[model samples]
Target: MSGVRLVMARHGETAANVQHMLDTRPPGLPLNERGHTQAAALGARLAADPVSAVHASVAVRAQQTAAPVAAAHGLDVRVVDGVHEVFCGELEGRSGRAALERFMAVYEAWWAGDLDARLPGGESARDVRDRFLPALDGILDGASGDIVLVSHGAAIRLAAAALLGDTAETRFLPNTGLVVLRPDGDGWALEHWDGAMPVAGDVTAGGTPA
Candidate 1:
């Protein structure tokens, strides 16, 4: 407990999540009723965990998800633009199996070390890393204790994998799931992930969007 710990949480469920739509970008869909419940549960789960501050992406879902957690600690949800979801571009708003398949294909390529692979009219893995990692650095800069960040599924998976030097299979981070990291030298050391340390195995689910 010498240095600070960083918690990257995937936002709660949304209508876009239930319908499997590509809802990246700001002002995206808010959390559904179930999502609000999940957010509150997330807050209760972390209420006793000392949190120095709460940060979220510009997307409404991310901000909304961070609210209860922030309120629990008497803090406000600080929105950071660079942590937004990886834009789906031409794939925006589509929810068919084919759309998700194509999106997963590119994302898996990134986990397989193809950071240059770009989504169809969307962002490259490298593009996500560039913005996401720096934003995390700024959050952790001169901080202590724990910091909570609520973000999207794919973006969290992509950025977390890079930060932990992991190439694990590209599975979506379930709603409110946390990826914990601690400052290790100039980089990071994976402390906890999905309730365990980082693993190399693949975890499959419905091909979900970021």
Candidate 2:
């Protein structure tokens, strides 16, 4: 097996993020000004790595976030399928506290190993994993060296936890925050998560948001 490291990043900020909306849809909002700066910083942060490929989901924000990093490596940001955010379904565009709580409640359920839990009119944890794992495999198909993928928060958290058989290293995935993984036997080993090694029993938050 190759020593290829997978770096999964959450997309930069968007208006919806600031508003606390469940903004999960294809071709969703673009990154705001601050998001642009974060994108550049993320690019610079990873430029020195031997990044062989850069990828993004279908969301506009995700693509925008991957642009700088791909440019840094002289690589095109491959717009991939099935690696987007967790679909919010009926909660899409809803920013109310009740809806947000409901969504998080179900998301929390997935974190508790209840993969069948689904948001009303949305995907289940099992649904996310089925589509995501395949998309991730396809992204890795015939690929090598370091790779970067700009995606979403909950999606990244769910997938990474499932892949590593560990609880999410952090609860949030702030804009451009990274979750690094390396090949280990038939699975993967969690490397630096959200830019640092998490301490056991630590209840970290913002440090993980993206």
TM-score per prediction, in order, is 0.90, 0.91
Give a tens-digit lDDT track for model 1, residues 1-210.
356999999888888887778888677999999999999999999999989999999988888999999999999999997898888888899886777778778876776788899888889989988999899889877888899999887788788778767744434468888888887886678877763322333222532554
Mind giving the per-residue lDDT tens digits that candidate 2 earns over 1-210?
A: 386999999988888878777788788899999999999999999999989999999989999999999999899999999988888788888875677667867866776778899888988978988888899998888888998889988788878988888554555667888999999999999887774433543332222122
Residue-level error in angstroms, candidate 1, position 77: 0.9
Q: What's the lDDT of the predicted structure labeled candidate 2? A: 0.82
Q: Where does candidate 2 stray beyond 4 Å?
A: 166-170, 195-210
In model 2, what lDDT does residue 184 have? 94
Report how far off residue 19 is in candidate 1 (Å).
1.0
